[model samples]
Target: MNILKSFFCAGLMSSTMAATSMVSGSAIAAEVKLRLLETTDIHVHLADYDYYRDKQSDKVGLAKVSSLLKTARSEAKNSMLFDNGDLIQGNPLGDYIAKEKGLKDGEVHPVYKAMNMLNYDAANIGNHEFNYGLDFLKKSIKGANFPYVLSNVYVLDGDKDPSNDKPLYDPYIIINKDVIAEDGSKHMVKVGVIGFTPPQIMQWDKANLEGKLRVEDIIDSANKYVPQMKEKGADIIVAIPHSSVSTSERKGMEENASAYLSKVEGIDAILFGHGHLVFPSKKYEGFPGADVAKGTLNGVPATMPGFWGSHLGVIDLTLSGETGNWKVSDGTGSVRGIYKRDGRKTIPLVEADAAINEAIKHEHEETIAYMRKGVGKTTAPINSYFALVADDPSIQIVTNAQKWYVQKLVNGSEYDGLPVLSAGAPFKAGGRGGPDYFTVVPAGEIALKNVADLYIYPNTLRVVKMTGSEVREWLEMSAGQFNQIKPGMDGEQALINTDFPSYNFDVIDGVTYKIDVSKPARYSKKGEKVSDGHRIVDMMFDGKPVDPKQEFVIATNNYRASGGGNFPGLKGDNIIISAPDENRTILANYIFDQKTINPSADKNWSFAPLSGKAKVSFTSSPSAKDVATSMGFETMGMAENGFAKYRIDLSK
Candidate 1:
């Protein structure tokens, strides 16, 4: 006998046996029971492991999620699984496919080959999907088993049918299924799922999408279509938006598509992604009739599972026959990992499907061979162990490479005399990213795969023209790296903001600067100047005060050039030159160009004088001990207190 609990806003009641017995006496007997399963932001880790580093990543990949999908289907009467995009262009495997295999017309892309095995009902386009040229995207989509949905992106062609000039995916897909009601009767549910990508893709990848296509605001597109979907006999509406809710200064406001689409009259549930965080459940007050926290949007249920195939979002709906609408009865969203790594042995919790695994086995094997192809040689072990506490050789090599690449370009151009500065941040600096995530290059043959591991993103090198004052403001934003200063002296504590994103703390290697956390920060991470006195003090170039009016050429990624870091005066008009080569590629070329390059930490950048200190603790995996100690910091004995603490003299 299977015992199931029936839930409603009123209360929960236990019932024995099948779902058909309870609804015999009701006036309206027919009811629909539909289950929606969603997977979002699976960044191309299809084989269940990170092939670039030759290890298993517990946080991402589809191997772990396969188990959750199996378990979810076993519990549901009628189910449909949908992927919410970002499937292409993230890991080293994605790079291997794009750069090596080269997707030509009629050829199947590796990501699509992996995704086709999953049998997704429908998928949305993510901003990262357009990172490669539009031609590549067109070829990849041709081989997909499912129809790609996009309501916002439009093709521009004169008078002719847009579909004729350019292939456009359908805006929405309506899936019809027979759902078993509690009373043993079957009801048909028309699930209309609409997909939207953020309109900001134009700004992020203007080179690929600007003149060829146009993206409208998310809200405007959803509003125009909700009525149409409803008119088309869609009983339940789900908006699969590849946009994230804002978590900045405004806490609960729905800044993205999920929040904005939930307010639309016909939307019943919202499946969200792109921010890469989990929102199991949330409530938006401004939207009427939608109570998302209770699993209901406008009285409908909504959920966003975490990214990287870590979790499968399950939303269960209880339909009302009298009103002809669905409401969230009860729901739960959770993360599922494939294997549990205790020590040397990894315990397998989920097994990969034989068919799916076997289908891509050849491609998987070839990808490994492609990544291991050697690029150059490294004289010393390059790692990011001390990246957070002090200057690190791993990041230094990247910045050094950027400076080398830009100096040649500047010398060839009219701006040869301008001072060139390299700005780079440590991506894997052992904070939220676990211990093994840190970049550790052995002193030997450095492969292209290893180079990719050091710089994970496919960001292009861009030169931005910034004044010394704007550069000062940019450094001030990075000053958020330190803990708040205390009033009186006399304290011994750690002096770091463990929660600060390591990527935002720009280490400008060519210039010398001291961050005075003793003074308030002049600018917030969002580029807002909160305090009058600048946190960056005594900024010097070649031991001389930097001229406020002097122009400088700064090397950074395309993301920063398009204002990804919220840095002041680094967006739009400030861009001087956009290099076609990726930043990591430039770094690789620089290493090869140098033949034998030695990267050393300058130690030019440091925190301001500490007035008072407080003991702050942080947690790191055991693997970071050796790297941490090499940077001149003492790691206290391990604490069963759930976090690791390192003692540092805050006083300058």
Candidate 2:
């Protein structure tokens, strides 16, 4: 207990304290150096360019971070680089390869090609890896020269048998590495790597994963596998957890599992991913057992490299004694930033690695060629600066595309001639992604890059049957995006709840509604109903009051159809058409089918009446100048953390 606190405090002050302690240590004390290199959620970022904008960006790319990795490795004698997963399926490059240029038999994925060049020691699979289906994933995995480690996911044995199912990949891998102890004595070390991703994959990507695979909870997988690795003569065990640190402790079967996984007995350290966030910083200041400045939780060292290769995660551990009897005496976790987003400006640290840039040069050029192709022309500008405050055109185009595709699929079926509805969420709204994150396509020719910007992910299309009341409940959940405003209150109130993910704020296109922010939210993100205050009010459909039993076919994505956001009244059984097409393709094809696209939000959603001045403040992009007041926002000017402040007036 004393040792844990001592190391925690030592790491709190960082290197200076550790250096001071080392000098005062006994003369016989032995010390050795080891570094753990991690790359998580790379998401096919091969170059420092934004495919959506069709321009070079200093903020992202694996090639840029690969340069940092080489420098980091050069400083350490005993080091191993491991990718923690989510390497595929994020931007336009991943989409073009998935939908346009299909990977042929034995062809290596561009992500793996670059990763292989980096010589990753081991890796695991993240939820996004299944976006292209099991076959594509298998072929991509085959391209990696390093060992693939995954502990939880399993494949069914037979059509009628699941009890005897086996793991889809190896549960763990032990790598033999060289280490130099005190007195310059060299010894061999066995390092075991175990990995776990979100068990909710069975729900998020059900169409491709159901009836064929099963997943175990992350904590369960760690308890079952860590002991086995320990028994296999591993001197040190490193856990590659493709999950975020949960907000709470010992919360059973949650999506973010790093916090709980650290409590497991045999685990030495944790490498985090899947949240697309940076840790060991001020972001997790008061989190349980998490020392942000020290980069640890429960005395166990953990690190999560920022997503899209924006930052490289580096952990340094000082080992003592011989390699076979090595013990981690001191540890610290930190991130190397490639581009620091100071307000609106970004500061780049380094350029792309020459080797990686040259290796994937062909694919990089092809991806640009694909993104630059003109799809159609737009009469009006499309941007997400005011998406949350008002019904938005960026989302309108998506809903229109989904409704068009779903109507075609059910032309002669039982759902034919049924009232079709679609749900679209603003993907590029300003939040954790910063001010420049919002999509801005000017009034001109629309290209594949514009389409990619409108819809950021590669989620598949799905049509779900829902009742009117259920639809209202869905709107109520979406209303969680706003904060409660009291009537007659004088001071300015926060309008948007930053904790709510922008992708889950689905707005129904065919319906007109008002969100009463004075009421408390009906349910939390975990589907737990905490209060009964109704936020959704005046919900009407087809110019008439909607009935509780009225049915409608709603077009959405696979993630929402199978309950990714825990919205009320949603289940897989309600899905009507699970179309095997990417939403990005549907959007692009829809725009191309119509020579000109002129989409404008129909004012379907609004804030309900309040007694006092209907004033609330929100943050958006500083570039929303010409369209700010036109979209119903009173621009306040640029705020902190790369966001522009704005005020919304419901009385306007």
Candidate 3:
């Protein structure tokens, strides 16, 4: 029987016995006391507010989690508090400290300052730690109070010399904690903690970490080192992985370190992150026992808390003492949210530590002042609301800006006369992320910092040369953004896959063409062409089909140019020119060139046909209600799932 069922049955039997002995009231059963505490994917949200927008965000911030930690710790005698990586980056405070109040060599970062106040026992590194570079990472580590472990990432030792410049971190750490055994005897069990960062960092953050470090596959590293940890007197093994389990086959192919690592031997528990998902509660396809509530990883407890300090994961472990070693008998894991009041929309429950808050208070103020300083002006509102539906004003402005910048730089050159198609994705369309996440820029003075908020990614502009055929294939791959069209369907079928990652669906504004949902997609998510011909049927240049031999100049971010998504013909060799400036800068320059710019939805991009009405769900903040309704959908009443849902008519 399952743990909950067993507990229920025991209760029922006890009640029955009590009823039989009703003539004499019997003693009630004692409750088993065991507690665990955890915090995952804090992402350096130390304060209770969103420093970027200078507004309060109830969903995130370590200040809120601090209250949850204190209360949970108070509930148990033997409780272990842990953090599951991504502790660095995300907020303006982290950026300000790293870029502005530059780290003194060998000095601790402010994140470490706040983390130290929490007294975290162990922590794992997330991929974002490598975003700045290796030197910056090493300096940040110097400030950490706890050990950072990684089993997969290794520094390549030149000439295989042990004394030579070697890797920065140890593979795993064994933590010995005293606990009462099943027999009620006090004992010490050495819990082995191993950490792994996704190997895809070589591609994702190629600029910073490439050649300096080497990352082996997570499963390979786990199989290699887990036995060693066990041999070295570790009673239990826990994996702190900065990766998520794959939900769709499309997402599965994109490096999920946890799915493979969980199946490895000797691993007792797996603490996962990186795709920024909540787990044990939400199951993904291909993840073993993922559907099982509070499931065990290889018979050991496994969990992943939601990202950005919104939730804390706890695992209460029970162990048995045997000779010199200990083994896990059973355990339960749960995810808890941080809130001040019991009701929904309760203000952040926890208060920031006075010392930690004071430490970075000046840095915070300086960042605010810097962000408020205006760099330029915008005559119109630059919002990301309708970005996904059509040629969004925000994206259109960015594209126009990039095209203008490119045209000026290559004036009178051979590439200058070529027609340019600018591609941009909506960076801030609220989903999973709460209401405050949407990018809503007021019409007025525009600052460089605000530009950063507009384009959160550091992607640069690059021009790719592709034929008409390649362009159609590109759109077909993007068409995967919507659900597959069923047989004999009509009307506005729920447009593409809502979770297909807005970045992958390249919306080209300059060129106009109608998407035929009647046809099948030409390519798979990995860029493999499907057997069915092509879905992008009507490719036009000037009211006529594009010449198959003619080459078009496509402007896009460096990530897409370097084949970030498996889009065809956009990879390495197709590049015609690479701009040194970031896409956001190009966009800013474009807006400056065109004093008054107006962009609207082209209605060229739509999904395949639909059959019967199906409920399509996605996370959105309250602010997105108008935008969603404009796209033609029945807005479902709001639920407390941290996001709103809507029903779209699919039956034609």
Candidate 4:
């Protein structure tokens, strides 16, 4: 107790008081409402500009959210701001700062420079923070003016007891601060903040964090620390679990275990992210133990702000009773967005904080110039607006690049004679990311930005060896992106399942198959087998039925090869070559080498004709109308949130 007290007393300062001490015997007359503001999954969007499209966007960026911060803080009597994580690596600007111009000693990272200006109280370390490796992560966080707390992840020091293992960062921190009650009386309070990242980081970033670090389950870590914090004189405990909310039986180390974490004792408030969905919304209305109306999980106040700075989460707690016996009497949670849409018009709810944009102006300009450098020319237009509904040229070009690069590396190796296949998915098909998020590159000169738009993630190349039967299972898993359609039904059925992310809909280029949506999905969203339904029909390789026993090489990214998206039959052991170069870089190189390339879909895959009167419809960008018409589809008119609805007559 003395050691913990000494550490907090050494460097802690209250938000309102110059010098404050832990309240041992202070009395308060009335209740105090403390506002807890959170921004999660910022993903280094410091500016309100899209680096891929190279245009101004009013929908995203922390600069826009920063304006909401000032308003939110001004409305509350007492408040604290914290970021739930995913702060360092999402957009091209972040890539420029980390890869092009590296962070050095005495240099502040651009994201941190902007965040520091907002006066953040503290932050959590999200799972994406480990994508660039440990040294880079360490260097990036050093520039932050505020502290970081991560309770679950730790260094492997070969200790007999896990509790004694050294944490990669502070497990928790107790901030002693003075607060003003409604009666205008001042009282000191101890607020303990603890954070947890998903345990799957071990699998997601295995190459960078294999033997160096280990992560524990979120509930276990919270159980271990919350009691200790209370014993160490913490009046209120706030948990920032960077995982999402799930209402499932606690099986340990499960991703999206925030609901289970809420059942932990002594936690007053919860702020979670990583699912990139808003809390208290209709999305989780029937989820067990989750009160969508009250914005809580297991009756504890909680919220998850949308990703990429689209929204801000706020939790207000009414604290009552005396200083030593203070408790939360009432609690509420809500989210505020930076923009809203009415029909086709997007209305900006807040302006970008000019200070934040100014802080990173030089880096932002460099990133724009870096992306605008010409790489090659494209003979046909490329866009992802129709990628999910049909075979798309945008995805075809990426798979071609992957197969081209992988063939060169395995020419004389042990896997030379095996058939090579490439897997690619539409990353920007615009579900939760909004209508303008899809890729669109015109038929003309191509630049580095075009390649980046084609393949958004920073995943490195990896080749996995699998049998022909295993490939079938892989396709079946990817087929979960579609919902089962009934035959001979009336009215319209949704063609695309919004719950399944478009990035996980991997299409293998070397095989030809048709998706039968009338059949039920064989795998669940978590990649577990739920039924024996077969969706992939006429599975052919080399103009014949694929042999189940034949072996083949699959060119893919590290995330898929290492069990990301929970795909079937992947656990990192089957990888034949783990290339360190990013897929986007390989794509850029492939385009440059060709000088002039034709991006045309080979029509390798399509949906099997459905015999029914029911119309199949899907929503996409309003700009996709011309392409949809060219493919013999008709626009069904506008859908909600500015998305244009289109119908596909499957009987054709």
Which candidate wins on TM-score? Answer: 4
Better of 1 and 2 by TM-score: 2
For candidate 4, give the lDDT of residue 353: 92
Q: Residue by residue across 1-652, what tens digits does model 1's lDDT show? A: 1233324422332233232333433234445566778888877777676765776555566756766787888887778778888887888777777777777777777677767766677888888888887777777789898878888888877565655443256788787756677656555667788888877777677667767887777777788777898888787787888987643432231225565566678777677888666554332344444454555544446666766676677777666663245443444333344544455334667666555556667777888887787778888888776676577788889999999999989996978899999999888766533445678788888887778878888889999888888888888888777666663545543456764678888888788888776677677665777888877888999899989988899998887778776677866678888899999999889877777767677887876555545333344545666765765556775533223556545454
lDDT of 3: 0.68
Residue runs of model 2 more than 4 Å from their true location after superposition? 1-30, 159-163, 249-251
Give a tens-digit lDDT track for model 4, residues 1-652.
9999887776453322322322333453458889999999999888999888898889889999999989999998899999999988988887877878888888989999899998888899999999899999999999999999999999988765665679999999998767777755667678999999999999889889988898999999999999999999998999999999765577899888888888899999999999999997888889988888888888899999999999999999999886777788889889999999988888999999998999999998999999999999999999999899899999999999999999999999999989999999999998988888899999999998889899888899999999998998999988988888886888888989898989999999999999998899889878889998789889899999999999999999988999998899888999989998999999999999999889999888988888866468999999999999999888989998789999987764
Name model 3 segments beyond 4 Å from true: 1-37, 158-166, 179-186, 247-254, 282-287, 339-356, 412-417, 486-493, 524-531, 542-544, 570-580, 588-652
Top-lDDT candidate index: 4
What's the candidate order when arranged by decreasing TM-score?
4, 2, 1, 3
The parts of candidate 4 lying over 4 Å away from their true place are: 1-25, 158-164
lDDT of model 1 at residue 568?
Answer: 76
Cα lDDT computed for each candidate against the true fold: 0.71, 0.85, 0.68, 0.89
